[model samples]
Target: MTSMRALGRDRCLQLLASVPVGRVVFSMRALPAIRPVNHLVDGNTVVIRSNLGGALASTATQSGAVVVAYEADTFDLDGHTGWTVVVTGTARLILDADRQARYERLLHPWVDEPMNCVIGIDCDLVTGYELAPA
Candidate 1:
């Protein structure tokens, strides 16, 4: 048997910080769109690098702040044990040149294309669960 345990905010954020990649859920053409991307946890926020021309960046810029969800997880399929985390919050483009430059240095995109924009998602609600052997 297996048991599921709920994780607290602190632990959830910690687990999120431990992972390098996650899926960001956002609105695209009035529909939910998800994209897998690399990220970094900065304080209570998750930061991702994207091209200025990308939908995510453009949406955030146009709306100032967009509600979004971020999910990341790791699982041991054989053992059925691992952790999953989801964060809901507002995503905004980091407008400060210095901060944007700092984030660019801290997070490198997976692709070779130019990623000139940095988006920060301020975590408002964090929920997580851990599955373990009973």
Candidate 2:
């Protein structure tokens, strides 16, 4: 087993931005739930779109904070190398018109429902790790 290397904030953000998909973690009724979501990285914020339901929509609408994690790396059983990145912060609904437009242009929800909501996570804490063959 290899030791995990601590990744800087910049590196974490970079990895998150480069990855096209991530998992959004939030608490629902004191229980933690994680769901796969499409995200758009805008500076220090991570933007994601959702329909009218689900934990993310409900959580964001209720003014709740969440932790979004994005990881990108190759994994193999033959001692391959890879990396993982995690981001934790406060999440809220995006209400700004300009910001909404920008995020809308960048992200398109896969569902057929009307995607009139945008949730953004203020990346307050970010960390990552890399695994490589010795």
Candidate 3:
């Protein structure tokens, strides 16, 4: 086991910038669900693209934005060296067409489907840690 130190908000965001893919945790059908997604960090916001009618997109479009947790990690199983970052915040659908387009250009998803639905999560509570043997 190794001791972990807390990472500051700035450091967390910086680490996140280097990460291209993350897991988005949200609620669907009254149950918690998580999906692997590609994202782009725009300032303090994390943006993701999804199908317009998908569960993720629908949650963002609902009233009173959805509370989401975005997590990304890099680690080596043999060495156990890396960092894990988790961000919890409100997520909403990007209503502005121009802004949506900008996000789409910045984030490239693996899926071939059209990423017309843009969801942005405000990095309100950024928490991260580096894992290394003491």
**Candidate with maximal TM-score:** 1
Candidate 2 lDDT over residue span 25-44, tens digit each: 77778887887778878888
TM-score winner between 2 and 3, please give it: 3
Error of 3 at 35 (Å): 0.3
**Candidate 3's residue-wise lDDT over 1-134, tens digit each?**
77688899999988888988999999899999999998888899998888988888876776659899999999988887889999999998888989987887778889998778888899999999988888
lDDT of each: 0.94, 0.76, 0.88
Q: Pick the candidate with the highest lDDT.
A: 1
Residue pairs of candidate 2 with colliding backbone atoms: none
TM-score to true structure, per model: 0.96, 0.85, 0.94
Ordering by TM-score: 1, 3, 2
Judged by whole-model lDDT over C-alpha atoms, candidate 2 comes out at 0.76
Q: Specify the poorest-scoring 10-residue window by lDDT in model 1.
A: 54-63
TM-score of model 1 (CA atoms): 0.96
Arranged by lDDT, best first:
1, 3, 2
